[model samples]
Target: MTEPVLTVTSLVKKFGRVTAVDGVSFELAPGASLGIVGESGSGKTTTARVLAGLEEPTSGEVAVAGEHVRGRSRRARLRRARRLQMIFQDPYGSFDPRLTVAESVAEPLRLHAPGPAADVRARVDALLDQVGLSRRAGDSRPGELSGGQRQRAAIARAIAVAPRVLVLDEAVAALDVSVQAQILALLDDLRRETGISYVFVSHDLAVVRHATETAVVMRHGRIVERGPTERLLREPAHPYTRLLIDSVPRPGWDLERLARDRRALDAL
Candidate 1:
């Protein structure tokens, strides 16, 4: 059997007495996508941070392609980075204002392992094209691009190193719905072309439904329910999950009734 591309077990992170992430666990097979869905403070971003090696877990295990990754050593972090790259919620904030888009995209390539300038430019061009950006877009700065364009550039940069896994934390949250759909489609295409796995963290259930093969529902730092995205959304077993689902605005949802329903679910 093909081993999973990413595995996380008993993951926990704490800030003082508060547990930001509690016993979280999941797996991502090669070319698969997993969505972590929850409210603002439900630990979705915390888990993503731990997986991406930005934050050390208080206790737990995270492995990429069967290799354990944790610890603060420069070597350890770099080694982990070779297998995973992360895309953040704000593309503009992630990019260096002084660097042009092409330069920003090439930064990872040059940092990990420098190559000839021509080859680097070619890779940057290809990555830009792959993410639906034109060669001209590379000349522009992040500040000059639209939110969606900046995100495409961000995705290009994240994938330049050819990491096996990408951890996306609210990657499309700041975009318009149309732009969000475009980014999601770009992500799907990238996965198909590269055989990469994605750990997509988002609060948007509709986006998660369309983006992930499997989904995990988080509440107060713990996973309350998890399964295939469709099944879990269609028949949510946990009250929190149900509440989340119910919270989405539908065609004819009554606000007053929804408020009452939310109160009832919260009481449960």
Candidate 2:
């Protein structure tokens, strides 16, 4: 069997008295996609942050491409950046406002795979094209592009170094329905083309279903249920998973009842 590109075991992160992530663990196989699904405050985002090394794990292990990411020196951190990258919810925030989109995308290439100036520009152009960004969009600053465009640029930046894995924290949560679909499709295509695995973190069940082959649901910093995405969505055994499915907007969704039910579940 092919080895996993990313492995996270018994991961825990605490902020003082509050445990932001509790014993979270999962693995991503090469070129496969996995979703970390949850509502707000469910610790999905925290898990993604820790996986990307933006926030250190209070306890547990995170290994990317067979290298553990903890207590590493500056050189190791740089190597980790080349092997793994993260795309945040706020795409604009991921880039330097003063830099144009192309420059932002070119940043990683210069750092991890330096070449002649012309070669770097060629690689940047190819990346921009791969992500479906127009030349005009590439030339514009992050603030000048639309939300969807900025996100495309962010993906380009994350992939510039040819990272084996990507930690996308609510990567499409900020976009509209149509834009979200587009970005998800783009991500799927990129994964197929580049053979990169993904740790897709999101609160939207539909989004998870669309983007991932397998998924794990989180509640209050712990995984409540996990399985193949379709089976888990269709036959959720856990009460929390069922409640989460029912909470999605539908023809007969009752906000008050779901809120109360969730509260009751929390009390259990």
Instruction: Judging by TM-score against the true structure, name the best candidate.
Output: 1
Query: Scored by CA lDDT, what does every candidate get?
Result: 0.92, 0.90
Candidate 1 residue-wise lDDT at 161: 87
* Candidate 2, 1-268: lDDT as tens digits: 8888899999999999999899988888999999999888899999988887788899999999888877657886788898899999998776899999999888888888889999999999999999999988999999998899999999999999999999898899999989988999999899888899988888888988999999999988999999999999999989899898988889988989999988988789
Which runs in model 2 stand beyond 4 Å of their true positions?
A: 254-260
lDDT of 2: 0.90
For residues 1-268, write the lDDT of model 1, one tens digit per residue: 6899999999999999999999999989999999999998899999999999889999999999999997889899888888999999998888999999999999989989798999999999999999999888899988999999999999999999899999999999999999998999999888898899999999999989999999999988999999999999999998788878877888886788778877887787
Angstrom error at residue 149, model 2: 0.6
- Candidate 1 deviant stretches above 4 angstroms: 254-257
What lDDT does candidate 2 reach at residue 263?
A: 93
Error of 1 at 181 (Å): 1.6
